[model samples]
Target: MNITTIGFDADDTLWHNERFYVLTQERFADLLADYTDRASLDARLQAAERRNIGHYGYGIKGFVLSMIETAVDVTDARVPAAVIRRILEIGQEMLRHPIELLPDAHKTVAAMAASRHRLVLITKGDLLDQERKLAESGLWEYFDAVEIVSEKSAAVYRRIFNRHGDGPERAMMVGNSMKSDVLPAIEAGAWAVHVPFELVWALESAPAPTGHERYRVLDGLGGLKALVDWIG
Candidate 1:
């Protein structure tokens, strides 16, 4: 069947998202190096994920705030005012850094758009941050629609599918996160492609059915051309 609509997950799927977070996080850890080790700092950040998922929802910004909370809670050593200023600076830096899309993302997305496929960007994150990134990346124009959701659940996918009024079989989802991009789309009866990044966070679950024929894990975004061509 010819593909009619394509749904894409932003962040690590098309761009270098997690790496920026990782960089800023390491810097944050450096500021607290005297009070906390790298391993311990990572644990504290992980703990914050567990704690804040219920309260703050998801995304890098939320994770950054969690790091701040972790710093405030774990360090018995009197954190100087300078250290707090450093943490806030790191957060501001994260906000200002422009989004860097993965290799071939622009070409592939443009290629699909040229082929008359309705390209929709479905991302979950802080609404304002996600919007800023999309606006800055110059990718917003390529999509027919853009959704910034709180979480990637079955209901979210279902809602997008319902809005399209097209059958799920004709829709395709591409992304790096297995939990957020692949499994949920598959459960919704849509085809999914996985272009994994170098690092997958512990908070995001891994893809379980690695060998499923309907699911694909590409070496990189360049391979997307062949996949989309075949689907066409």
Candidate 2:
């Protein structure tokens, strides 16, 4: 089947998302500086994030909670209230940070939209935060659909593509994460395109589907529209 629907992942894929977390993590390291060194602190925080994701899901809130958990752990529950306050403030700063669209993000989505393909924003994060980002992004109108999911799996991809387009066979999932966006979408029988961002979070990291025919990688989103045309 010809690809008629395209799934775009938000966060680092469309705009500057991971960079915020990178900055906030730096702050987290600072907040816990007296408790542990940077290397150890980073490892602990990553461990915390991995554990908390199942409970808190994903987004600024969960990230903040993970930071708090890490802080408490490294300090053996002796973490000062002031340090916790600063952590909360850090999260608020992130939530209020302005969305900066990645290079070619707008043009590529517009081109794909104009070409008459159904463009769906498929992302997993806090619902209100994701909605807020989309509203401020100014690319909202270009999307034929928007899915704010708690997670992305083969079943979710199949259901989304089938509902929003023809089916997984006629859809393409485009994003930066190999784990969340690529592997599962391909497993669901859709084309999966990996467009790398500068910074990939540890949790989102996965081995590329190296030899899969359905998998494709672009240097960036600039080449995406042409590739979609070629695929069609």
Candidate 3:
């Protein structure tokens, strides 16, 4: 069966997203070493997610802001104002960093474009951040449509499919998050391909399906071409 349209999840799907977060988180840990333990800092930041969900929305920039808030709350030291400034600078750097598409992301997307398949990018994050990443990544041109959603759920996928897909059988979702990318897409009646990443966040965990015809898991985006070949 030929895939009429293909959907992709941003973040860890096509590029090195969380690794940048990891790098900055390490710096944050080291900066707060005097006032708090690394685990403690992480816990506080996690707590801030609940607090800021309504205010800042979601994405890396918001997360870095939460880290700053957490730091200020924990330390209560004006001396660390400089540290806060540095953290903000890091966030800016993260946003501006050039696109680092995963090994075969560009090639795969180009190939798919050549095949005349409708390529849509379905990512959930801060609207500005999502747009900026796509614009800078040289990938925006490859997609026919781009959906920046608030969360990755069955309902969200269904809505996107209804709007853009060729029913369930002909549209496929490819991404790195099992919870978001695979399960929800499969549940929405679209085929799913999981490109496993090394670091899977706790918030993004859902049970793996037992035996689903529409589900697949792979090592990385580099394997996507093979999957396309197999499917085609």
- Among these predictions, the greatest TM-score belongs to 2
In model 3, what are the clashing residue pairs, if there are any?
none
User: Which stretches in model 3 have alpha-carbon errors above 4 Å?
Assistant: 76-79
**TM-score to native of every candidate shown:** 0.93, 0.98, 0.90
The candidate 3 region of ten consecutive residues with least summed lDDT is 72-81
What local lDDT score does residue 181 receive in model 3, on the 0 to 100 scale?
Answer: 88
lDDT of 1 by residue, 1-232 (tens): 7768889888988777888788887898888888878999889889988899878887766777787788887786466878877787888888888888788888988888888888889998788888998888878888988988888876777788667637567788899888889998888877889888888888777646677656887888788768877867
**Residue 151 CA displacement from its true place in model 3, Å:** 1.2
Task: Count clashing residue pairs in model 1.
Answer: 0
Between candidates 2 and 3, the one scoring higher on TM-score is 2
Tens-digit lDDT string for candidate 3 (4-33): 778999888888788887788899888888
In model 1, what lDDT does residue 26 have? 82
Model 2: per-residue Cα lDDT over 109-212, one tens digit each: 99999999999999999999999999999999999999999999999999999999999999999999999999999999999999998899989899999999
Q: 8, model 1: CA deviation in Å? A: 1.0
- Evaluated at residue 145, the lDDT of candidate 2 is 97
lDDT: which candidate is best? Answer: 2
Worst 10 residues of 1 by lDDT: 205-214
Clashing pairs in 1: none
Alpha-carbon deviation at 99 in model 1, angstroms: 2.3
